[model samples]
Target chain A: MMHLLKIEWLKIKNYKAFLFISLFFLIGIFATNYIVYSVFHNIVNKSDAALLLSNFNPYDFEHVWQTVSYTSGYLLMLPSLLLIILVTNEYTFRTNRQNIIDGSSREEYANVKMMMALIVAATSTLFVVLTALAFAYSSEKDFSITGFSHVGYFFLKALSYNIIAIFISTLIKRTGFAIGIFFIYMGAENIIAQFLDVLSMKLKSSKNIDFGSLGDYLPMNSSDGLLSFPPTPLKSFTTSSLPTEYTWIVLGFAIFYLVLFSWLSRRLIIKKDL
Target chain B: MNVLSINNISKNYGKVTALQNVSFSVPRGSVFGILGPNGSGKTTLLGIIMDVLKATGGTYKLFDENPDNQLRKRIGTLLETPNFYHYLSAVQNLKITAGIKQRGENDIERVLEIVSLTNRKNSTFSTYSLGMKQRLAIAAALLGDPEVLVLDEPTNGLDPVGIAEIRELIKLLASQGKTIIMASHMLDEVEKVCSHVAILKYGELITFGNVDEIFINDDIVEVASSNIDQLKDALNLMPGNLKVEIKGNIVQITFPVGSANLENVNQFCFEKGIVLSQLQIRKKSLESKFMELTN
Candidate 1:
């Protein structure tokens, strides 16, 4: 596995687009976090900071991990796009065929892409941890490791997004079309999830026919459910706090989607001619 | 032992047949050529053997075992144009290939030197010309020092000098006891480097045999006289003539190898009262041999 990752690293280590996209992802996440942190640093008081900032907290130590993890979720698309470009570039350049001819198996090729996703996810997660720690030290909030589990969820969510992107890229083979489809799927899945949510609500209102949160089981929405902005504004609207049990359920759904996308990508790579 | 064996492989792209029931094998230490014209299923056959393209129906074996990644690792291949990350340098690209082949990185320099690309090893692949790209692809194929090398149109887009360089490199590799399966539409290229050849036309194997055997030395007797029609008639009267034709004032007679010499043809023409003005023996070329087979 490490050998395969090393091979994958060699292919992209000096690639300009890969380097730029990765650096963009790293800086994009940190810069966004910094801008949001600085914008609210002076406006919100300590007591209301938790409510106003919600999950964007760079100051508080107790919930800083969750804050950084939740805030970094917005930047997942950067790495996802990066993965899409990397995979689709192989098709564009026809190096995927060369790779197999040079002796790498289709399974190895697909596994290398999955390893790349893991590495990208790990890198993003590392940034989140580092940003959280730096903010905690600067703010001097009670340094507790209480909400660290959210970091784990953040990593899994990031991996799931990248896996899905890779799956789409492998299936589509064209960079522009793959990315276009990815964005379309991203938009369409949210609409479908919302439609399901609304339908379930209407059925309950009209006939008291209760169907549990089936929309949350969606592939994309399930990962989104893994972490969310603290709902200070929507407390009165509904579901003020995400239950621990619900987070676990979403984690299960996230894992399921991750495996499904990975399996499908492998199947496509192994079965399809480059 | 056979270095590679392809058994009744067939491939179809929807309605277009890319390859139909093609079967051939490369003996160990022999320079084999898959000779064919453009779109003659040479690349398709090589692709199927390398596992880059799937066959519609067939099976192949490498070194007497089913082909897997492990078996493929023992055979280096270059298919079609040189496919590498254009942004990466030759050394970098080769490093990736070495990693894929599970070979030592130190082998990179040796292969680079073998392909004569050591000076430009650090140049990005996009910066290299078509010839350089092809040489670098050969270098990548030589990385692991595999026993077999499968090359598909290695000189397809090269200049005369580039073609000569690749031909020499292939000869050098073959001299080192590497089994080379090269595909080319250029009959002379195959004639120069291939010990054995298989000719394909329209996805069908038309002929397969030893190159020397296939290109037998049929004696070409070029006979001309003051009366060309009389010389032709005299050559026709002669027994054991394979073909007789008149071009301009010369009546060319073809005879089977070792059957007729220049003296015998000259004596026959003189006995028939047609004294030869020009008489020469020319050996038939592989080009003509290929044209005959393909036609």
Candidate 2:
């Protein structure tokens, strides 16, 4: 495994585009998150809406962790793009063919990408943790700390997104087309989920039959369900979490999607004629 | 000992069959060449053996062991063209290869020196010429000092000097007791560098054997005299069931393998009062032989 990681590192260590794009996207996510945090903590806290929702605390150490974890999920697409480009470049440059010819097995090659996904996931999650640390301490000097599983869930969400990117890159084998189709897929999954949610709502209102919401089980939404946003003045009208019975179900679906994507990517590389 | 043994191997890309029931073996320390025309399954066969392309049917063994990553590590292969990271320097690209084979990183300098690319080791692959790219590919193949080397069209794109350089390199490696399986469309290259050869046409094996056995000593003796009529008459009287023909002023005689009697033909012509002007023996050219086999 370490040899494979060394191989992947050698491929991209000197690649200027890899360095620039990865840093740009990762820092871009943090920068965007910081700007949004400042707008809410500094400006929104003094508004008329703040009095009505006094219980909601965006600056508390506990709330800051949730705030950062929830908001960082929106920027998962950036790191996912980096993963897509890195994987597809192997095909574009035809190095994958040479790598196998040089003596690495197809499974080892696939594992190299998986390791990179793990590293990318680890790096992005660390950034989120750092952002949480900065915001949590700056907001209050004597604030009490809370649990860290939600941050861990945020890591899984980032991992799921990048693995999905790897699957798209492996299936398509073209950079521009993979990115284009991936965006289309993201939008299409949401649209399909929303349509099903509306259908379930009508079924419940008309017949009093309590069929469950189908949107929470989608590929993208399942991972998004890992962490829910804190109640703010803006989103107080919406429900926060899924039913207690369905939390484990959503988590299981998220895990199933991650494994499914990784397995598919491995199969493509192993069985391909490259 | 055989370095490679392929048995009834076949490959098909959807409807197009690239290789069909091809089988051969390369003996240890021999420079074996796979000769064929364009699209004759040479590269496809090499790709399958190197594990770059999975065969549709049949099996192959390397060093008498089942094919696997560990077995492949003992063989260095360059299929089709020189494939490397264009943006990275040759040193860095070789580092990746060495990492894959799990060899010592110190071997990088030794291979670069062998290919005479040490001066440009730090240069990016994209900046190198076609010949340089080819040499770097050879250098990559030499790392770990494997017992076998598999190269497909190793001299496909090169100047005359580069061709000679690579030919010399292959000969040098062969002298050091390294087995090489090379594929080429250039018959002359194979004729010069290979000790054994296998010819393929449209995915089927036509013939395969040692150079001397396959290219039997069928020497064509061309005798032209001042008196063409007398030369033709004298050639007809020659013994040993030789095929004699007249082309303009020359009497061309093709004797059976290893039966060229130059002295006997000269004496017969002299006694018949036909003063010979040209008596030359030409070895059968590999190009004509290849055309005859492939066609």
Candidate 3:
């Protein structure tokens, strides 16, 4: 098993796609910091200094980690699109056919590809963390940021999202089709969660639904995840604060889809002639 | 024992039949040729043997065991053109293929040399010519140093020189006592290298035998004589392994299969004063014989 994994790794190591992904997220973290500082720094000049950033440093380790991990959307689509392109191109390129002819099981081939995508995901995640930390210290002299939770949360969230993306892309070889489905599913869940919360607020009792657990809906029902929730509902929208359970739900779905795609891709091996 | 054997294997694509009750065995260390025209289930059979496609019926055995287990390490194949990662260099592409096969070594160099692509090893796969790509495909097949080689249309699109190069490589491999099963539409090539041959037509085995058995037959003796009538009359009187005919002052006689008594026949004709002008022995080529069988 290790031998095969190594082989798969070697095959994917030189792919231009992998290189592009790693670079995209690394550069994105720095870009996000520049944009945020440029837009908000001047506005804070007339405001209370403590309320702004304590004026000591906004570029502490904690803040850097947050920016890097919190802003990994650029990499969210990497795993899905990359895995799909790798798998689907086998049909058009005919190389996969050659693989089968030389005595490789389809399962072995799929396993290698999924493993590579996951590795890329992990690499991107780590790069975001490292890049954030690199800038955090250089930007600050007197203080250091604390609390790994925010940036950690960001990493886990992106990782989960990327895993599921890879799963969907592997099962459906077409890039556009898988991404379209992803958008629709995410969009529908957000809409339904909001609508249900609104209807509950206007009821005779007017009690909000406690989607307090992870099974049905997400916290603030958004992919970015919520660090804070507003006290008042400007609209007839109110719900119990999201439980950490929603994270688990999202994570579980990601795992389930990964396993499912893995199984399906493996089974497809014996179905066709090379 | 046979090196590769498929027993009563069948595969169907919806209503279309890809293979039907197909069974054949390749003996150890022999150049076994599976001869067939396009779409005659040759590739399907090779696919099943390699486990690329599942069989709808029957079982197969390789190297004295079910192919699912031991055959992978035992067999190497170049089934078609190629499906390599074009952006990667030749060495890089091979590294990936070798990795999946699970017996990683530096045979990438050995195989590149075998294919005469050692000078171009660093070049990307996209830069390879069609023949170079095919050679690299075969190089991939040789990666594991397997005991058996299975190739389908190995020279499908190569120029004559490239085809000849591949043929030489195949012959060299065979000389090392490796069992080789090659499926091809080129009858002349099969005749040149294959000791044993199986002819498939429309998903059925038309014939299977040693090369000599399939090709060995009576040789034609063409005789253009001064007097065709006299030669025919003299030949008609002859006995033992002879069939004589007369057409336009030429008396043609065909001898029994495997009989080499042409000198005896010539002496007899001279003694009879037939005055032979032209005499030539005609051996039937595999192509002509194939046309006879398939038609």
Error of 1 at B160 (Å): 2.4
Return the lDDT, model 3, position A242.
Answer: 34
Query: Per-residue lDDT tens digits of candidate 1, residues B1-295?
Result: 8888888999999999999998888899999999988899999898888888899998998998889988888888889989999889998998888888888478988888877899999998889987889888888888878889989888866788878988998999899988999999988889899999999999999988798788887878887878877777777888863699998878778888756688877787778887777889888887888889888
- The TM-score leader among the candidates is 2
lDDT of model 1 at residue B270?
77
- Runs of candidate 2 with Cα error greater than 4 angstroms are A141-147, A209-212, A240-245, B223-237, B245-251, B266-279
Which ten-residue region of model 2 chain B has the weakest summed lDDT?
Answer: B211-220
State which docking tier applies to candidate 2.
medium
Question: For candidate 2, what is the DockQ?
Answer: 0.75
User: Across residues B153-260, which tens digit of lDDT does each residue of candidate 3 receive?
Assistant: 898778898899889988998999988899999998998899899888887778887878876766777887777787888888778747888756677687767664
lDDT measured at residue B9 in model 3 versus the true structure, 0 to 100: 82
- DockQ for the candidates, in order: 0.76, 0.75, 0.44
> Candidate 3, residues A1-274: lDDT per residue as tens digits?
6776676666667888757755665676667666655544565534675353445333455455555565554445555456556656665567676676655666666666656666766666677667666666566454455645555555544545555555555556565687687667667766776665455444423454444333234422334442222121221233433332355555455455545545555555435454
Candidate 2, B57-111: lDDT as tens digits: 9999888888888888888888898889989999999999898888737888998
Q: lDDT of each structure?
A: 0.84, 0.84, 0.69
